[model samples]
Target: MTPRELIDVADVPGGPPLRLFRRGGDFMIVLERNELMSTRMHGSEVALGTMACDRLAGRPAAHLLIGGYGMGFTLRAVLGRLGADARVTVVELVPGIIAWARGPMAAVTDGCLDDPRVTVEMGDVAATIGRATATFDAILLDVDNGPDGLTRPANNGLYGNQGLADARKALRPGGVLAVWSASSDPAFARQLQRAGFAVETVRVRARENGKGAMHVIWFATKR
Candidate 1:
């Protein structure tokens, strides 16, 4: 097998630099030796969007806020589940990831950024949630690995007490806040429940063919 070639690198706030690699026709973004997201395994990423958007399908206008834009899989999937009147606000912290989306991974993005219902913001996902008040029908969080903050120590706040409260405050009544995790965290689930959400834990397959490792997604609906 041929070795993966490193394409570029970018520094991330409160974390190490992100490394981009290419192998054959696929791409991967990694932190140190740990692979973050890949072009190959995307089933769970798509599920992250579908699970959140499906719950918001019946809502009018369907204002959605996506915390991260990893390869644009979740963003694209959410757009597919939403209607013409729906609006998706994607906040990607890393500017290089956005550049990579339009450059090396343009095919993976598939013009989701160009959609009329989409608005892109380059800033901290946490900051966006902090200021928003009952503004979103669904908030899809696919940043870091989960509540533990594998990518950045600051990411832990997204699953922390004040952070969870902020996320809840940003959601409308009956709105859903979905979080993607590489593994299960019982404590995180409990946090969601304590934050006034009806928690539903879902175990999803990582690969599209249902053959890879299982991942966890928590759907926390505002009460």
Candidate 2:
């Protein structure tokens, strides 16, 4: 069995650094010692985009904000499901991750970064949500594991009461906020409701073919 080799690292502010490793043809991103994402396991990530995009399917004015560009799986999935007129703004805190997508992970990304409907921003996604004023139709976040599972101290605010409020403000009326998580958190769901969002929790397979661990995705609609 071939062992994973450390290929690159991205230094994050107020958080653990991101480590990139490659083994054979597969790649994985980790924070500290815990794996953040893997090229081989992307089912939940794909669903994060597709499910959110599906909610805004008929809307011609669809504009999406995707937080965290891990492996570009969610970005690519959302792009394929959205219309040409739709716009996707992806915010990634670690610039190196984006570079890795274009460099080592090009095959998986499929050049989605350079697509006409997409915009890439190297910054904090939490800040981006706060800056927007009813700007997006859907805001998807797959960062820092989940609300309860915080890999970084800085990411805590994103799942906090104020952060959820900011996300609510960023979305247009009836806009959706989708968050991908490794596991379900009842408290997080309650927090979403407290922030005036109509929330629905869905349990999905880790693999697209329904063959892996059950992952959680929250669908919170701005009310």
Candidate 3:
């Protein structure tokens, strides 16, 4: 197999670093120091993000925080589901990934950045969450592959007991924290429990083509 080429890198506030690269036709974003986001066929990323958005039902002027901006799939999915009163804040660590989404992958995103309801927070999601005064109705985190934190060691904190507890504090009562993972993680689920969240795991197909690896999403609700 041919070696993957490094394209560009960017910095984030809290430490899960950002590095964007291309391998042949595939584009990848390395968070912390490893690949945190990638595009497989054409629409798997959007699909996974959509799975999280699908659970966001209601019309309470929802506020959402998306951790990663990989090709803007999750942002696009959220926009499709949200009403005009809803607001979405996308916190992306990598400037290059945002640039790539506006540049090479613009067609896929379909002007999501320019949408009036969307706000782009170009920093570590943890920083924004820690500082935000308002609580969100939903927090969809797809920044890392799973709870183990392969992209960056610091990301493990988000999946750990304290991190999950912080997330619960960030949300409004009964608000949901939807996390997408490359695989199922029982320990992370336990951590969510310890954080005082009602958690549910959903297994999903990885590829838009309907045939690929199986992925998991942990939907944890704050009560």
Candidate 4:
């Protein structure tokens, strides 16, 4: 077996530091004992982007907001599907994650951050969402493990009732709010309904080849 090599550590405000690891060609971003993301298992993340874009099929010049640029999988998937007129804004809290993308993991990043259609914001995604109103066609969130904020306790607010309201307010009419989770949460799905969204929960495989652990994604369209 190839040994895992320690790459770098990134500090997260209001949360524990994240560690990057490399094993041969694969890269992993881990938080304490839990692996937050990996280059090896990004199918669900890609689906988060592609599936959301599918819901917005007729909008060629759509504007989208992405929370957390994990391995750039979701962003790349979105870039592949959207037209040149489309716009994507990505908000990431940890600086080192971007550094690693431009630095050691450049190949995996595939220069997605430098795409002309994309904008990189260095801050909490919640702030960005709060500042916008009927601005985006879609908002995709893959920040924490599920909705409970495994990375940062403050992130928990992004899944709370107020957060759902803010997200709804930030999107254009019929815009989608796509959330990726490691597992399903019935309560959260119901909360989406209560927040006045037409929700659809999907189970997707972690690996691109249709194998590996099953992950959950919720597509909640604004009413």
Candidate 5:
């Protein structure tokens, strides 16, 4: 077996963490002793973001909230697809994720954070959403492993019934909320419906190579 090569490093809250590294030609982002994300699996994230934005294609001055800043793939894709008048608020739980993007994974982002329309919030995405008014045009949640909550234990509540209710109240009338999951959760879809969102599920290809797990994205619209 061939070992992955180290390319660059980043700083987390506790210590100096590996940020970017190239194994052959692929780049990966390491966070807190874990490879948080890699370029090899970026397509699925971008696809989820794009599908969410697609539901709002004709809207002007749309306000979007993105949960998670892993490698900035979701942010970059939304920025590219949105109109100039659209505003994006990205809420990341870890400040180190932003540092990794600015320092090591800068190329992937293409300076999207510097855009005047983009606001970077260094905090938990759920807390950010809780404080906001019902002013968002769309909400994209890519945090954790999905409704199962793999990355952070506390993240489980984000997909719970109450969490879904909060997200519904945070969106404007007819607003869209999209969630990316590693797999399907039938209970989650039921919760979305209970919160008054018309829901739809999409299956996406795992990687740019077009082979891997079949990821699910749940698109819900406020009623």
Candidate 6:
């Protein structure tokens, strides 16, 4: 068995610090004992971007707001589906996450961050959403384990009623809000409905080979 090697640690404001670990060739970003993300199991993360772009097929110049740049999996997936005219704004709360991308994880990053259509913002995604009004064609969120804010206590607002409402207001008519989760949450689906969105909950496998743990993604469209 290969031993896991610690690469570096990053501090998260209001939450626990994140640790980067490597075992063999695979990398993992762990929050305490809970592994937040891994390079090995990213099929669902890729799907989050691919499926959301599928919904916006007709729009060539769509502006997308992606929350959290976890290992750049979703960002790369989104960039693959979008055209030259399309724009993507990625907002990340933790500065070290970006540093890891450009530093130790550069090989895995594959120059996605340097893409012309992408804009990197170091800030809270909720604040970015609040500042906009019908500005985005889609909003992709993979900020926490799920909607209940396992990463940080403040993240709970992003999944609550007001946060959903704010998200609705931030999107253009018929825009999609894509959220990724490690597991399922039935109540959150209903909450999306109550927030006046047409919600679709999808289950996807963690690995690209279509074998691994199951994950959930909620694609909520503004009504």
TM-score of each candidate structure, all chains considered together: 0.98, 0.97, 0.84, 0.99, 0.88, 0.99
Query: What's model 1's overall lDDT?
Result: 0.92
TM-score for candidate 5, residues paired by index: 0.88
Model 5 Cα lDDT, one tens digit per residue, 111-202: 98999999998877778777767879999998766785556667777888878878888898899999988778888898889889999988
Clashing pairs in 6: none
Model 5 misplaced regions, further than 4 Å: 6-21, 30-36
Q: How many residue pairs clash in each candidate?
A: 0, 0, 1, 0, 0, 0
Give the lDDT of residue 205 in candidate 1: 92
- What are the clashing pairs of model 3? 17-32
**Number of clashing pairs, model 4?**
0
Where does candidate 5 have its weakest 10-residue lDDT segment? 9-18
Give the least accurate 10-residue stretch of model 1, judged by summed lDDT.
Answer: 51-60
TM-score winner, 2 or 4: 4
lDDT winner, 3 or 4: 4
What is the Cα-based lDDT of residue 134 in candidate 4?
A: 99
lDDT of 3 by residue, 1-223 (tens): 7678877766654455577777777777766555566676424456655665666667468898888877777788788888899899898876767887887667766899999999998877877777654388788887777776565566777777767767888887778888888888898788788788888988777666777778888889887
Off by over 4 Å in 6: none
> 46-67 in candidate 1: lDDT tens per residue?
9999988878757989999999
| Tens-digit per-residue lDDT, 67-185, candidate 4 | 99989999999999999999999999999989999999999998899999999999999999999999999999999989888889999999999999999999999999999999999
Error of 4 at 83 (Å): 0.2
lDDT of 6 by residue, 26-126 (tens): 99999999999999999999999999999986696999999999899999999999999999999999999999999999999999999999999999999
Q: 4 or 5, which is superior by TM-score?
A: 4
Quantify all predictions' global Cα lDDT against the true fold.
Answer: 0.92, 0.89, 0.76, 0.96, 0.80, 0.95
